[model samples]
Target chain A: MDMKINIAGVELDNPIIAASGTYGFGHEYNEFYDISEIGAISVKGLTKSPRAGNPPPRITETIGGILNSVGLQNPGVDAFIKEEIPFLRKHRCKIIANMAGNTFEDYCEMAEKLSAADVDMLEMNISCPNVKAGGAAFGTNPDTVLAITKAVRTYAKKPLIVKLSPNVADITETAKAAEAGGADALSLINTLTGMAIDINTRRPILANVVGGLSGPCVKPVALRMVYQVHQAVKLPIIGMGGISNGDDAVEFLLAGSTAISVGTANFTDPYACLKIRDGIKTYMEKHQIKTVRELTGGLIVESK
Target chain B: MSYQDYSCQICSQQEIAPNIIACCLENAHLAKNAKPGQFLHIQCGDPASMPLRRPISICDVNGDELTIIYEVKGRGTKALREQTGKVQVLGPLGNGFLVDNSLYKRPAVIGGGIGTYPLYLLTKQLTNASVYLGFRNQSVVTLEQEFCQVAEKVTITTDDGSYGVSGFAITQLEEDHKKEVFDIVYACGPKPMLRAVQAFAEKTGVPCQLSLEERMGCGIGACLTCNCETHEEGSAHYKHVCKNGPVFWSQEVVL
Candidate 1:
């Protein structure tokens, strides 16, 4: 079994990573677990300028999960590159910078700056509904997905991992478009657009009428999409959605993810990422698998 | 970068009073550092009821553990109450009270409704203090005898005259001040009550510090969800209740 696999041209110690927004720039979870425990970290979605973020009621929890419309809130690209980048570099992990843009230009500007900054990869966010240009408009249409991916891919010197939104009619067409646009790798599925209603008040639970849903409820949907997209495109795939424990992480990898990102779980337990990290090695050792890279999409298909 | 949330296990859960529960946590370190008037961010469920965590104030600290007492208010609080065993809590966070006993000969502790939870610990830290707590009626009055153990005088007020004193808590705290001259006033509870205490402290020109309340996210200061405007400015020109204070000098806050 080979331990080394390539994401674009860069090498990661493992295929497990703490996802964006959930990890909060990796510096935070470092307090509970060692930074070296995970393969990489996708920092929170950053824009061209600092964002104080949306007004209150940005987050609410539902019966099996939580919904959020944080509006891609961050201290902007400059602060992230200046203040946040140095801290990320101190840790031994592949730093995947997640970039969000209100317009194509904001995407280009952030990608260009982060490309020059010290980072191993760039994760382009096309699924965020918090911004006008984000959400379904950029994700649903294949041509728009291609155009935006092409635009950001030009400025990104590192591996450009275009995150695909699952709020579309067909996931394959969109994944193919990202491949056509030169995405080095792909990630799915970004939070599905969802809303919860307060029956007594007859009002939406979120301050924003709608929000993105992530957690255990969406795992089957995400796994099915990852499997579908894996067949549609040749790009290395990073899968995420309601992943909590090592068993869940293995399920995503076996479903055809080259790597997996742990979201929602970080809030359930701050040390959840480290738990998955250790759990993966234990799983591999028990199965007599010498390397995690061997587990990527290694599911034995049973006859229907 | 200094903040993170964890799934805190319930070490001990005690029913301190009717509709009020005192929860002890497995966090040895948190119980070690919490001071009077401090708070903790609770994740009501494994995935959290809201995208963020709910903030609760510390009621007592014993050894490597701390206690938070609360009445079920909404979904977040309701989820916390239903947690069968251990629940996740983020704190002992926010600045606790200023208990510098050297500056004041006598201290007065005031709490209103569920806000009295923090005052239970605040009065214990003062050299000499009186406990004045108020609730809606017989259903809300909690921790009276426990407060009596720490305070020189324990005054309980209920709106229906079902408890010790009739009328509001402020009326009880200000009934008279001639004993030792309460030089410092400390308080917690709903904002209206804290405001009333602030008014009396200002009228007497007595040094006062009030325990404030705000819903929080990351209790260590990173997430700005719990920010409140004050006379003091930090990196962002606002003080975070989860970090700089859930406890602030009465004068330092805008209201």
Candidate 2:
């Protein structure tokens, strides 16, 4: 079965892409398997300047997911181009530079810089809820999402994907706003804002107190948001939120995501993307599906 | 070095202490490749309840058998204790301890509580190594015999005078350092113990390697969750404990 799919104009070998923050520069996972086997890698969130991120105890486990307030720790965009881009260029898969900023200027500067670099696509990470500034603040509001997307769109030479925050009322509003702002495509939902507490210490587990939750637990919420956003916007969706296995990927496609990104699953299994790719193929064969694209929005909801 | 997810089977398991269990697995590749300070990212429980893998340090390796000693702390480890037969494991991950006996002779190996488990493998690989171990009390003291078999001398301390030397292990290490200066120091323990060891190593001007533990997400460099602060040329930067090291030089990290 054909597994290739396209996000915006960029073609992928398969529908599975490694989500940002989860897969750092694609160097670490390369040790487990050839990273080129996956369609694309959304490198860790990049900022204009190097961010040291939050203090220790930045991560904690919840019921079936994890809470992280990493606060976008990265080596800055310049370093990424000089140090990491070369390593990623050697690999065959497409590179999606996931850039985050505390301001619209930060996003535009990074977009202009990265678009001139070797990356295949630029993902505006306005949805990161861990930071104190411009991350989710710009993502949660429709006007701000449109404004940032429009600002970054002007500078980004490559296809731009606006990652959406899940901690908002009516995610479709932001989805429509991104489309309005000239986003080539949309990806959602970025981690849900949540917190965990220690009863004994009577303190929040994460040093940042609040963090974004991702894993199998958030799959349902992500799928619902993806389905809703797909209905609300004309742009293709890259569905993500706790997708672990093949069936989960299939669910997202049926929910109207053109392609899917694997996030927290990479933690549980290093070879998760490869396994998920194989799982998608297996699912396609079992169902006599020809192309993986046929599965997108294939859900047959009976009219009751 | 490349790492693979191996389907390993439990060879044998036994409870060495209250809430502490030592289990052995059959994985020839891991046993042969695993070095001191390297860890295994194990899928302990069902993903629905415990989604992330539990990172456990390598305790010992004998032929095709790899051993790990873990304390039942939370839901994940509790699920690990109940696991039987086949288990999926990704290892031997992160940079292992660099063993250069010619560079440094008379190594001082110090460990505290559950932190002492990973040091067992290091102690076994070293020559003329004096070990210092600290535990809560007698009931939790484990691998004492294991360390004794490998080390040139072993000193164990308990906080409440319930076992061996009644005091902190760092005190014993300091007291012993005066008599015969150790060429190199290696330590793994709780934060306070590690901090104290870091200070001692700095004050003595002896080269030291410390094995650290953090709440990790991916037991690889991919997830920036497990990070430790380090200073280089006066600038502090974050290093992933899973990648840059579970082990680092004494002067490398901030704490």
| Candidate 2 global TM-score | 0.97
- Give per-residue CA lDDT, model 2, range B46-162, as digits (tens): 976677888899999999999999999899989889889999998888887878889878899999999999999999999889999999999999988888999999999999999
RMSD of 1: 4.0
RMSD of 2: 1.5
Q: What is each predicted model's overall lDDT from 0 to 1?
A: 0.77, 0.90
Q: Scoring only the second chain, what is candidate 1's TM-score?
A: 0.89
lDDT of 2 at B189: 91
Model 1 alpha-carbon miss at residue B100, Å: 2.3
lDDT of 1 by residue, B1-255 (tens): 344454466876666567677777767767777788877777775462354467888888877667788887677777677776666666666687788878776788888888888887777787678778888898767788788888888888898998778898888778756545777888887888888888888788888888876645455544444555565432343465766788888877765
Candidate 2: true contacts recovered, fraction: 0.66
CAPRI-style grade of the A/B interface in model 2: medium
- The CA lDDT at A212 in model 2 is 90
Task: List ranges where model 1 is wrong by over 4 Å.
Answer: A1-5, A133-136, A197-203, B1-12, B24-28, B40-55, B72-91, B103-108, B164-187, B191-245, B248-255
